[model samples]
Target: MAHDGSDRSGRTEIDHSRRRVLAASGIAIAGSVGVAGCLGDDAGDPFDDYGPQAAALESTAVSWDDLGDLEGELTIYSGRTRDQIDPLFEMIEDEYPDFTVEVDQDGNEDQLNSLREEGENSPADIFYTQSSGALAALKSDGLARELPEDITGAVDDDWSDPDGEWTGASGRVRAIMYDTDEFDGADLPEDIFAYAEDEQFQDVISTRPNSGTFRSFITAMIEMEGEDETRGWVSDMVNQQNATLYSSGSQQAEEVAYGDQDIGLGNQYYAGRILNEDPDATLDVAFTSDDPGCLFNVSGVAILSASDRPNLAAEFTRHILAAEGQEFFVDVNGEYPVIDGVEYVGDLPTVDEINPPSFDLNALGDVEAASDLLREEGMTV
Candidate 1:
């Protein structure tokens, strides 16, 4: 496999139509993606501009008033943890005090299951999850409603469902989050296969075996490499290298940063979010020599078909895609903003430069086989 960010890994070279699901950062992809948080109860502009770039930000971002008098309760079944998105809820409250957003956060699979089983009586106005796969699943089941035009149009066409059932709220790039003091990322092998046999990485590595994005990556492997090869590679790497498995990407990055392990196979933002809190922390994110390990997965929102509050539900999605919401997500969570013009904070690579895999994003919806394969290898799913 070539170390440069080119398509020498045997996978098909996808064109722009297929490329819609993924966007690269200028710092990471060098092509697309032109790309922060806060607290408090203020009486001034409910949705005030954020950061130093607030005034200079493009005024095209849809505003709360743009949705036309949104009101009523909005229940959310979210995969994003409370701490990761408190700022979002706070802004919503400050913007529309009459509108209610009650969130019940859980694993994406669990919440997805709830939505599937609940159907019309799900009590969920929105399903906000970490995996586009889950959103795809819901869309396939006819469980999600078509988003309003403004909400759908707020983001790039590729970042949302082709049918407009869901829209990506924020994105995380798959990368090797490493302890900078331990290894120079620039010299790290570009091929993901290197980690399994390369003596330099051996037992010093950590990963999230059950992550939604991890399964998506496995699904891509199944599409790119045969199932047998992906299975063999995973089993060999886990057993041969004595790899340590963590529950979440954040934990994996934390363990590596503290020297519990030297390297972590996880999303790029986990390290950035951690670094913001502890500047002295010896953690930072690095990409694969190219795109092998860099899969771009998104956390997004969808309106539930059963929702009686379509106006409010659409308005919430609208708020999320606009500038105020985009800033809060990027600044606080360190994830990529899906829309252009929003400020991108942190030292992470631009979305275009990360070199995400070319597998069609829409195809990632069904990954039960991949999840089962990971579990069958005696790995946690």
Candidate 2:
């Protein structure tokens, strides 16, 4: 998790001649038309359309019986909503009566900052967050403990930290959400870069460039394709002038589903959430090439370095990695399970088959460059 030391504010203010100036300047700004103010994104409802998981969906990850019960009360500082995590926490309490959890949920980024302020005396035993960026930041701050191989080894190498500080519980993929009423399935293109020239989708697709997911997507795009090319695509979209930015991904997806736009850029899980609220809704996910826009991000857990109950914290992580825990995330929260063997309850392509680009999820912790690109284009996050 190395910082590039590049400052986003250190740019020469440009004189624009419509779209041509940025072409020559080699740095495009999001047009003022559709962007949010470009500073930051508002917190979203992470538990939208959440429900209890299925009765019999078993997990392929470690079993509670295999791990054994060794828990007391543990306090969790969660960067996800209570509804997003309650079902799983309730499951742990019901199965192991002695293990109860007190969860305090807040925005991931804000909570990360708070933890840093608290330092070694932080009361949290477990830190569960919605983005790997927060997890990486914690690890980088020396606030996370290295997990034993028994916990870290349950999931694949890519799903956990390389230095073994955190483990991904569930995953989400970036997607193109299309309005079924506006375009037939074939009209939607899977490749986003190729979609730039698409007539129907031009000037209509929306995203929250300021949102955490959107920033991560753009950062990963920068990693997959160099800065200039990534900037070029955004410039093209900006030149179209109809490419819009939203306050949140779900709102962007809803606008597409409501027919205000033909397509939107958001998490694939968001479409699933819409379907949960309205099964007959016309919203559908149109995936892009496995590069930037379609990259996967995880909501992960880690035992804090300042825990008062380390063993209980680690056991809770085991419960989350178990089959039932994985099922809750896939079925209830509409996420891709990182632990193998849990059946995903949606129409999404299998996680392993998505063919997303290879990049360190940790490296994408800083989305400053991507936000700067959007801001320069005159767009907000």
Candidate 3:
């Protein structure tokens, strides 16, 4: 929890022309597509046929006890910090008086490695991480069990695993938070891509992708815009001498509030968490032009492949993904719901209204590709 809120010197921007020019060239040839512009067969219900494989896993009648029963205190290694996960624990206790859910907030890499080495014997039964890289890794290693059929059918098609391994429980958008006092809203860059060249924003932007959250954001960019284009954007970010990088998203938000930097390219939750902790923190979200660059990051929940409590785990998983579970997700956590109906608070734009770029969840399951992209951008974190 060290609060080193200043920009790190000796940090250099990457070369931008190669990727950006190529992407712009391609888009120029293909023509502009509407933000909510539909794709082939993407027209139907979001999760029309999700979880077909998971549906074949088990056919037991879902029960409250089945979902709630924990022979022992169930352990959770979550990406959420103590305050964020605390409300979830309280909700479980109230709903299922029969069992207890114990949680520990561990770093993303630690939890990923634990699940990898320990496999089915791992002490962690459920792992919630901010990025999909670990999920892709677990799936690649065959460490993830197919999600429950019921859970699959409930979430958006874009949110769940087609192969039934892991599903996105909640999502966060990659948005910019700026201090309006220092920069006028009308004068703000219209697209994040402009930050690299916009003279008005020079040395005023900061971000952190070393963490899993930022990793996914970049990966989504590569998928939507292609490798060269994404690489170009990162390079431009460096060339413009834009973006003071940090180790985490919350750190970036603090820099904006203190005026060390005016804008931060990070998740919306980091700003929300800061507000929850400090009511007077000055910050507001900036929406660049809706494109794949405005990536929608998934924070997913997956049952281990070797769980002795599959039934109990499935029950809990269903509860979290269900309508009731979805409501608590937004009401308490401020995350976007994966399920159909849930109310969201805050002044942030709605998912549809924001028209954030869409990325295939299946593609998100590719960790090697994600890792490679990060390295290509000269990102060590």
lDDT of 3 by residue, 336-368 (tens): 877553446555667876767656755665555
Per-residue lDDT tens digits for candidate 1, residues 124-160, read 8889988788888889999987765655665666667
Q: Note the clash tally of each candidate.
A: 14, 10, 2
Candidate 1 deviant stretches above 4 angstroms: 1-60, 63-69, 289-292
Q: Flag the better candidate by lDDT, 1 or 2.
A: 1
Model 2: per-residue Cα lDDT over 235-308, one tens digit each: 77767645887886667777877757877778888787778668788877767766787888888998888875
lDDT of model number 1:
0.69
Among the numbered candidates, top lDDT falls to: 1
* TM-score, candidate number 1: 0.81
Q: Which pairs, if any, clash in model 3? A: 13-238, 14-235
Which candidate model has the greater lDDT, 1 or 3? 1
Report the C-alpha displacement of residue 365, candidate 1, in angstroms. Answer: 1.6
| Each prediction's whole-model lDDT (CA) | 0.69, 0.69, 0.62
* Full candidate order by lDDT, most accurate first: 1, 2, 3
Candidate that would win on TM-score:
1
